[model samples]
Target: MTSELSWLRRRADKRAEIGPWELREGLRSRSSELRALLEERKLEHPQGTPEGNRVHRFADEALSELENAERALTHAHQRYKVGSHVAVGQIHIDTAHNLLLRLSRPSEIVSMMPGILAIVQSRLSSDDPRRARVEAIAQSPESIGEPERETILDAVGVARQASIRENLRVRSFVNIVGWVAGCLAVAAVLVALMGAVFEDMVPLCFTPYRGLEVGGYVVVCPVAMNPDPKGGRDINESEASATTPADYLVIEIVGLVAAGIAAATTLRRIRGAVTPYNVPVVLALLKLPTGALTAVLGLLLMRGSFIPGLSALDSSAQIIAWATILGYSQQLFTRFVDTQAQSVLNAVSAPNAMPPPPSPPQGATSSAS
Candidate 1:
C-alpha cells in the first residue's frame, strides 16, 4: 500500500520534479527492497489485495500512462529537443536490462546493491519494480502461483545467507585492526615522550647534548650536524644555545615506518576480497594519516631550530605525536565503519516469510487477470 501510494504521489509530480530517468533507476536498485517487503505480507496472507476493482482501474491507468509516455518520447526525439523525454527512456531501457538480471539472480548482485542505491538521477526501465510488485499483488493470488512464490522466497533467503557468510569471513580482521590501532596509538605516545626526554639527558652524554648550557637549565643537545658557516665558535653553539630540542627527523622516520607497516598489514588482510579499485581506495585513505603526521613533524623540526622553546622540540612535537597517533588510528576507523555497515545488514537479514519468483513479461495483450 505504501509503495503504491508513493508511486502514485510521484506520478502526479512533474517530470521536472522527479525525472523519468531517476524513477527507472530507483526501480532497478530497489527491486529487492520492494520484493522483500511485499513478500512478507503475501506469505502471511497469500491472497490478492483487499481492493478488487481498484486493481483493474490501476492496470488500465498504467497501460494508458505507458502509451502516453511512449508518444511523448517519440515527439521529443522527432523535435531533437535537449529536453526530449525519449533520451531519458533510452537511458532507462538500458538500466532496465541490468535491473532485470539483478532480480533474477539476486545473490550475484547483492554486492551491487550498495552501488545501485547510489545517486543516479534517472531510471532505466519503463516498468519500475515498485509498480511491478504492486501489479503482481493486484493480480489474483493465483496469477503469481504458489510455486513461484516459494521460489522467490527461497532465493531471497539464499541471497541473505550468502551475504552473512561473506561478512563473517572478514569480520575478525576488522575487529583485530581496530584493537591494534588503539594500542599502537598509546604506544606511539609513550615512545615519542621517551625519545623527547633523551634530548634533556646531558649528564648521560648522548650526542652534542653531552655538554651545553641552554636557558637557565643545563641544555643537552642530542645531535648537532655541520654548524652554519656564517657564525663562529668552536661549534655553532650560538643557535644551539637557547634550549635543547628533539630531533624531528627521527620522530618523522619512526612515524612513517609505523604507518607503512600498518599499511602493509592491512593490504595483506584485504588481499583476497578487494578488487583492484579497492587497492587505490585503501592506500589513499591510509596515506592521509601517515602523510599528515610526516608533514607535522617536518614543520616542527624547522621551528625547533629557531625558537627558545621548551626542552625537546617545539610544541609541534606534541602535535606530530598526536597526529601520528591518528595515523595509526585509521585502522580503528576502517574497522569501525565496516562493523557499523555489518550491523545494518544484520538488521535487514531476518524475515517471517519468503518472496515469490518474479514472472516473465506477459504478452502485449495482457494476461494479468
Candidate 2:
C-alpha cells in the first residue's frame, strides 16, 4: 500500500495514448520483493541467524537486485521515455515502485542516481584498492537517533508539499484546456442555432433563388456571408469568434498551444531537467488536438456557407485543402515539441559519466565557486 504521486497516476493514464515501452520485460518477481523490502525493511535477522551474517547476506542480495532493476530501467530508456507519449507503460509504486522509474524524485532514483553517484565517487579516489575503499566507507555507520530522523523526514514532507503544488499547476492547465474547448463548442452551437432560426431571407435582399448568374459562373445574393467574412483580414473576427465552426477551431487552438507548451516543456525538461515543468508541458500538449481542430474550423468558417450550403462546400478540393492544413499544422507543432524535448533530454543525460572535476589543487580555492 505505497502511496504514489497523483501525477504518476495521471501519467499512467496516457501510456496507451502514447505507446508501450518494452522496459518492463522480465524480473517482475524480483522487483516485487525489492519493493516490499524497501517499504517494510523486513529483512531483520531470524531467531537463529547471526545479526551481522544475516544483514550482510541480505545487503548482498539487495544490491544484486538493485543492479538488475537499474539495468532494466536504463536499457528500456524508460526514465526518459516514460514521459513520452510513445512510452505506454504502467507503474505501481506500492507493488513495483514503478513511478520512481520515471524521473520524479531524484533521491528516489536509487538505481540511477544515488547508486551511480556513490559508485562514481568511489572510483574517483585512486588511493587504495577501489573495492577495499568502498567497503570501508560502507562499513562506517551513522550516529543518527530518532529525533534527527524525524527532523529529516519532516523536511522531506515539506519538499513533497512543493511537488504537490506543482501538480496543482498541471491540473489548473487541464482546466484551462477543457474550458477553451468547451467555449468553442458552446459558441459554435449557439451561433449556428441562432443562424438556423434567423434564416428567413430577411437579412438578405434576396435568397438563393435571387442569386445572379454571370456567364459560366454565378455570383449574387448568395447568402454566403457579406463579401466572405473569413476569407480576408477583416473577417478574422468571424473566423475566430466563439461562434466559428469550432471542431477545427478548438483543435487548432489546442494544437498550437499544446505544441508550443510541449516544445517549451521539452526544452526545459532536457536542459534544467526542471521537474516542475513536466505537468505543465504535458497538460499543454494534451490540448494540441484541440488546437489543430480549431484552426481547421477557422479555415472552414473562412470558406463560409450556410448549413445546407456547407454540404455542397464539401468538394474534393475543399476536403483536400482542409486535410492538408490540419496535417501540416500537426506536423509543425510536433517538430517543435520533439526538438525542444530532445534538447532538454540531452542536457539531463549524464552530464559527466566521468569523475568529478578535480578539486582545487589541495586547499586552493577554485574559481568554480
Candidate 3:
C-alpha cells in the first residue's frame, strides 16, 4: 500500500510530462481513492467465512489490476511517438482504460441495480423467493446480507463480462479499420508511382471529338501543349506528348483535397466519449486513399467514353472539376462504413444498462391464457 501510494505521488509530481491532462488527473484522483480503500481493507480483521475470504481476495486482485493499469498508462505515455508508435501507445492506453473501467465498476454497481433487477426479474419466475429477495434488497440496499450480496455480485460479474466483450469487439474493429486504411494508402502510393513511371504507356489522355483540331482530328490531353493542331497527323500520335505523369498526379491531388472536405463533414457525427480509441480519425483516413483512387478511376472511366453524354472533356479545368466531383463521390461507398462506425461508437458509448428481456413465445402466451 505504501509503495503504491509512493508511486502515485511520484506520478503526480510529474503530471505535466505524462499523458493527456484529463487522463492524468483522473488516474491521480482514482489512485488516491484506491489507496485509501486498500488501507481500510488492510485494517479489517481476517474473516473465517468463505464469502468474506472470497470478497477479500477479490479486493486484493482488484488492487493488483489497478496497479497494472497505472503501469500501462505510464508505459503508453512514455512510448508515445508518431507513426506506428502512436498505434502501440493507443493500444496500451486502451488496455489501461478497460482495466480502470472494470476496477471502478463495483462502486457504480449500486446505481446499476435497476438494470440488475431487470435481469433478475426476467430470468427468475415472479414467485421465486430469491427474486423477491433481490427486489427487496434493491429497494433497501442496507438490508443486504452476505448471500444477497453474493447474488448481486454474480449479476454484476455477468454484466462486466458483457461490457468487456463489447470493448474487445470495438477494439478489433478499430484495428481492422487501421489495417484497411494502411493498405489503401499503400495501394494509392503504388498507383501514383506506376502513373509516374509509365506515364505514356498508361496515359490519362482522351481524344474528344470537339478537341483542338490536329490534322483535321480532335486531340485532347491534360498537358498545356497540344500536339501541333495543323501537323496533319493522326490524333493518336499527338496524345503521347500531351499526356504526362503530372496529369495523374494533379488529378490525384485534387481528389485528395475533395476527400479531405468530405472527411471534415463527418466530424459532426463524432460523439464525446472517454475511450482512448480514435475511431473518427481512422474512419477519416479510410476515406482519403479511397477518394484518390475513385477520382483517378472516375476520370479514366470518362476518358474511355464509358459514361454516355459525358464521355468527352474539353478543357483542363473540366477534368479537374470532374476529379473533384469523383473525389467527393467516394462518400457513396464510404457512407456505409461511416454508418457502421457510428453504430460501433454508439454501442461503446451506450450507458451500462441491461439488455432488454426476450419476449415470450406467441404459442406459450396463448397456452397460458
User: Which candidate should be chosen as best, given lDDT against the real structure?
Assistant: 3
Write the residue-wise lDDT of candidate 1 on 230-328 in tens digits. Answer: 223433244344224455334445456656656666654332332101222334344434433543343344335433442243233354554465445
* lDDT (Cα, tens digit) per residue for candidate 3, span 268-363: 877755554667888899999989999999988987779997777776778888899999999999989888887777666543334457798779
- Each candidate structure's count of clashing pairs: 13, 28, 0
Query: How does candidate 1 fare on TM-score?
Result: 0.29
> Tens digit of lDDT per residue, candidate 2, span 4-71?
67777666544422312333443445466565554333244343557545544544555455555544
- Model 3: clashing residue pairs? none
Question: Where does candidate 2 stray beyond 4 Å?
Answer: 1-35, 38-40, 43-148, 200-369
Those runs of model 1 whose alpha carbons end farther than 4 Å from true positions after fitting are 1-28, 31-156, 168-172, 198-244, 253-369
Worst 10 residues of 3 by lDDT: 81-90
Which has the higher lDDT value, candidate number 1 or candidate number 3? 3
